[model samples]
Structures are given as C-alpha cells and as structure tokens.
Target: MSRPRVQFMRRPGRLMLSAVAAFAVVQLAGCGKQAAPDAETTATLIQPVARLDLKVAKAAPGSRSGEEIYQSVCVSCHGTGVLGAPKTGDAAAWAPRIAQGFDTLTQNAINGIRGMPPRGGGADLTDIEVQRAVAHLANTAGGNFTEPPVGQ
Candidate 1:
C-alpha cells in the first residue's frame, strides 16, 4: 500500500519541465517588435462595400389642394371637432356655420374666427388655400363647394 501511494503521487520533474516551457513562450512574445503594413497591405485588409442607391430627381411644383392643406395643418383640430372646430364631417355641427355662406367662412378662416385659429394654424398658407381649405371642410360636412385656386 505504501508503494502504491508513492506511484500515485505527481512527479515534480514533469511540473518543472512544463514551467520552463511556459516561461520560454512568454519570453519569445516579448523579444520581437511587430512590423507595420504597407499601404497596399492595409488596403487589402479592408474592402469597402459599393453604394447601390440611385439618386431621385426633383418633382415639379404642383398646386396644393384644400384636402392636402387640411390633412397637413387643419386635421389636428378640425379632424375630430377639437376646440369647437365645427368638425369635418358632422353636418349638425357644421350647419349654422355653413349657413353663413362661403365668403364669410373663407374670410373668417383667413383672419381667424372665434376659437378657430387663422388658416387652421397654418399662417403660411395663401388666402386661396384658406378658401379652398374651408371648401374642403365644408364639402366634408355635405356642403357643395368648388375648390378655389391656391393663389394669393
């Protein structure tokens, strides 16, 4: 049993041999300086992807319809009858205001009426855009109206 225990014990000679091999590897890593790559070598290491998107040309300046203006600017308030905007679709809500005639409605819209902001909050809109926007709102409420030009 004592002889078997001695045979099972690890040999220190093998441990020392492994330690020397590890030390030689670490010393070799510290012995050499790395060389820099030439321009061609560097370029070969990194390849760029091609840009494949085609550039789109500009579109012509077209007339802005009343519906376009309403959706862009007025829809925030008028779309859901917010702040007593007379709603875009409810005839009962729009009736009294509609009876006032298109010209009055257009003027009020251009100048800002009661709780409704001017040009439905788009001051940059032309007077014609205001009139056409009113027509669009009025038409949505079942009133017949011709769309005015987006001028002046």
Candidate 2:
C-alpha cells in the first residue's frame, strides 16, 4: 500500500505536519514551508472558522476544541498507539482508521471498539461531548469534519 502522507511542522520551514494538529489536515496544503511554531503556546489552537445556526458555534471560553477533547480523553492511547489504537500525528496510522468512516467511529467511541474501551475509556462524558472530542482528534488526524457543517 502507498504510504499515507505525513505532515510535520519543524522549525522555520519545517514542513508542517498536518496530522494530530490536523488543523489544516484535510487540505494538507502540501506546503514545504512550516510556519514558525507559535512561541510560548502549549498547543496549537482551534478557533471557529465560521459556524452554522447551531449553538455549538457559541461554545464558551475554555470550552474545549476537538484537539482539546482528544487530549483530555482520546490522546492517552491515540497519542501513543496503545492497545493497537492509531498513534496521533501519524497520517499512515489514521488513514485506514478514517476509512472506517465517521458514523462507525462515533459509535465505536460511544460504545467501545476493540482495544478502545468506550470514549477511549471515559464513561461519564456525554455522547455529544465525546463526539466533539472524536472530531477534534479525527480532524487533527485529517478527517473532513462538519458536525456543525456550515450553512445549516
């Protein structure tokens, strides 16, 4: 199988890796130049590009992003590929996984997939909440997401 594209943001001109930070993942711009890593920031951030008529667009300050959700819940295993879970920031790892599609992924998280134990192991979080968390990671890892698809 062809190797899945992997994007990594290095120093000034470090080819930006569009993986876990799947921030720009779908586009994967294929840019050879990496933007200077933002200084003094603990993590790459997620800001609203635009929103639909849904209230999800109006999430409060400190309301987590998909990336944040991944970090909080999914990352522990995904970040390291523990228990056969895909590793974060690895497009190859995510490629086949994304092939499983969103609905299935969501259900897997809501219930529990093999190796993964429901919401990556958190049971108390709501389905919607876990959904956002899932999108964050999926998007970061490069999945065309639109839970709040525009123009609703």
Best by lDDT: 1
Question: Which portions of model 2 miss their true places by more than 4 Å?
Answer: 1-64, 147-152
Error of 2 at 134 (Å): 1.5
Candidate 2 per-residue lDDT over residues 1-152, each given as its tens digit: 98765554224345444244576655576867978877645343554566567454434333555665676678789887889888776778777777888887789888897888876776656666666776667776787765532122
| Candidate 1 lDDT over residue span 1-152, tens digit each | 35455532568787788899999999998887768779998887686666577997432233578888888888888877777777679899888888989998899998888887777788677777777888998988887888876553
Instruction: Give, for candidate 2, the lowest lDDT window spanning 10 residues.
Output: 9-18
Candidate 1 has an lDDT of: 0.79
Clash count in backbone of candidate 2? 6
Q: Highest TM-score, which number?
A: 1
